[model samples]
Target: MENKLNDQKISSTIETEVLVVGAGNAGMMAAAAAAEKGAQVMIIEKEDSINLLRLGLAGVGTNAQKRAGMTIDKYELVEYLAAFAQHNVDEGLIYHWANNSAEAVNWVEDNILKPHGAHLRAEPDSLVTSSAYQGFSTENDPTIDDETFVSYGTWFQEKIAALGVNLSFKMALVKIIKEGNVAVAAIVKNISSGELIKINVSKGIILCTGGYSANEELLKKWNPLALKKNVYNDSPRNNGAGIVSALDIGAIKDEEPAECIFDRGLVPVGKKTEEMYVQTATYEDWLWLGSHPLLKVNLRGERFANESVPYQFTVNAASKQPGYLYAMIWDDNFDEYAKQFHTLGCARVGFPGYMANAKKLREDTQRYVDKGLVVQADSIEELAEKLQLPAENLKKTVLRNNELVKMNIDKDFGKEAYRLTPINKKPYYGCILGGRILCTSDGLRVNKKMEVLDANYEPIHNLYAAGNDSGGFFFGSYPDRVPGLAASHAQTFGRLAGQSAAK
Candidate 1:
């Protein structure tokens, strides 16, 4: 098929049965699945190499779950996830994930992880649930050293390459060529050479370019509230190129704006939210101790919402606070308190059977203290002074929090008793907290088959979207309670889309 490009020169043309864009978690899975189905697959990644940062995969009834004596009702999980979005999500997509996530996870284990030295381990169940949101223990993380987590990405790349998929880096998808309403080819640009190449796709084009978390303009347009407080932590390449291309070709997107924001974005003592953008700090800068349900006070030195809620809820509350920032105040016994908090998902790194690296938590906290990002004082008044808060208000808040700790009850915010650790142990520490955006949770609409849908809710022929590039699963906020739900959704639907498109 010869497609004319206005004011653009094509340096070369390649033919493939499936063209997968953005070689992240979803694109890799899609390419591998298409190759497994005996289809010629070509993957183009804008980056020089694949992203190595790994997230746990949520699954139900998987072999790992069986071995760990963990049983989850997939239907109940589907309902909980839907309710998490206030029924604004596509429950069918959530059901699709619940049904096939096990297969997808096991596929990774059998083909990519287990064959190598790595294996999947389930996250520990929550110690207690007092809130309406219930978190499941279905998150599975690869057994690898945190420093060498890149090995998992390497193994996946090797596995897919062995399946005869052509993977190229530094090639970014510019646009999808469509004839009528059917996608036929794609125009990609070589980032290093600035040369445009056309790939004729006979089967389909799978967009896995992630979401617009890093796109400030899109964030301001769709999720202005989230943008007002969040520090972008995702890859900058996620600029909605895939979604924009699909939209240009008549694909519809989710109406409600959503984001996967987490708590613990460390804001410097006097830094404003506007000064925060792409977080360039190392992992040591992450306020891991802040993930614990510390006594959070606004700049006015007043206690706010229940700090024991989900990570994003803390940020949501902070968004309404003065300057969209809050301070997490704790004592020297944060290590013990963190364990008592029993935080779920990625924040569960201190526990066993997951990423058991508690030492890093302490080290990170100390690093922040050394850098002055976190203030350390021996007294409540002194700590309040260092944090630039009203000393009397902070002292009263701490006294009240201590009383709650003594009573084993949070009368004000109804925080779970177990997570209500006292901040009166002496040598008080405080760090200003903000929101760190992981990704946008809304994008191009897709059905269970991972087919991109048009305005009339009909499939855009031969066009597929998976991962953050596609939506209809989430609205308003990310369901972190599900634990690795986003990654699992990406892997599962990416495979499904690749299989459907290859057919």
Candidate 2:
């Protein structure tokens, strides 16, 4: 890591001690931490707000300060977190976050989001209600940030701004300046005006530019077995500018790829009903985590994986499907069972519809049928006819499934014995679940100091990476019941990257 005074002459240039790309949760945290440390922090973002992530109340953020009593997280609990993060996480970063994530939450509470009457209640019986919020239990995985703070990421961003850090929106990073293997500056582009901007960082360039989940081509590159791109609406331009820029500068990424949380329900993107996505993925994990023993199937209606497997595996399998869609047909009995298992906050109903909702929920699934997507009918023959599938094959498949269910075998699919049921519903609803892949878990390898690594295992000097951009922990599916794994990692690595860059 070479350290020298670098002043590259450009037509328009801005200097800063720490330059953070992609002002999402992690990047915002990085900017705030660096700025609070008295670094001239400049954050470059692509969205009007921090829209690259889905931030809700879930995680030990700065808000916990007001909590009269907050339980201290134990090392055993962090061990579960490590397991949930699939153990590729930096122990130092995890220690930083595990010790101070609640502190960050407390800071947010004291400085940012004033409490809006949100309370952290005990997670109910997951057997009855499928919730992966298992705290400190090795039986569960924790990817979801099930904290009690109201919009932690947004509030934290606001706090960063309050710290007098320079915040620029609609500014996307296009390049990273490597002065003979040492990062020094970055090239940015204003999306509105097509103006190329150069940002010269005298201190360092901390690439917090997020992950490449929104990039289908990058997704394919990361995980060749990945089927198709399937993330619910995020900034579609999140084509991994940070990771790609690093790659262009010869950053050899970590080998074990972590799969992004794939959301593949045909639904409207975010709160916008005006737009409809035919194939997407969001919160589909809840379905797999539910008590419904329904075996998933490809567009060909064949049994896929054990329902209890990690949602990422199911997501990966779905991506590998040729049609990139599946029909999850279950009986009305298991349907009723799942209905009885809704969480505490939400009313005991499966979504606003059955299990999940898409853009055209409760609409006739015939269009899906026309596209060889889904089929619904009273009799198996009618279902086959309507779906243009082999009627005899469909009947045999159902019969075999029923026989396996009766015998508790599941020899073909290896489905979990619990909650097993045969699909014998008359008015079967055939919804299309497209197998859209998020960026695979493969990320830019980084060290404990959050420095990007080369193939020779040397940390690239003056360059730091955070968030999904720094991979190597996730190999396959994320664990269950232990939410907060991703968000904590984001906070942990982001802050670590900032600290490293500031130093």
How do the residues 421-473 of candidate 1 rate in per-residue lDDT, one tens digit apiece?
Answer: 87767688998888877788798999888999999999999999999998999
For candidate 2, what is the TM-score? 0.74
Highest lDDT against the true fold, candidate:
1
lDDT for residue 238 in candidate 2, whole number 0-100: 57
- CA lDDT scores, all candidates in order: 0.82, 0.57
- List TM-score per model, in order: 0.95, 0.74
Residue pairs with colliding backbones in model 1 are none
Residue 182 of model 2 has an lDDT of 83
- Per-residue lDDT of candidate 2, residues 203-250 (tens digit): 777777666666656656765444342424333545778888888888
Q: What is residue 94's positional error in candidate 1, in angstroms?
A: 0.7
In model 2, state the lDDT of residue 463: 82
- Root mean square deviation (Cα) for candidate 2: 6.8
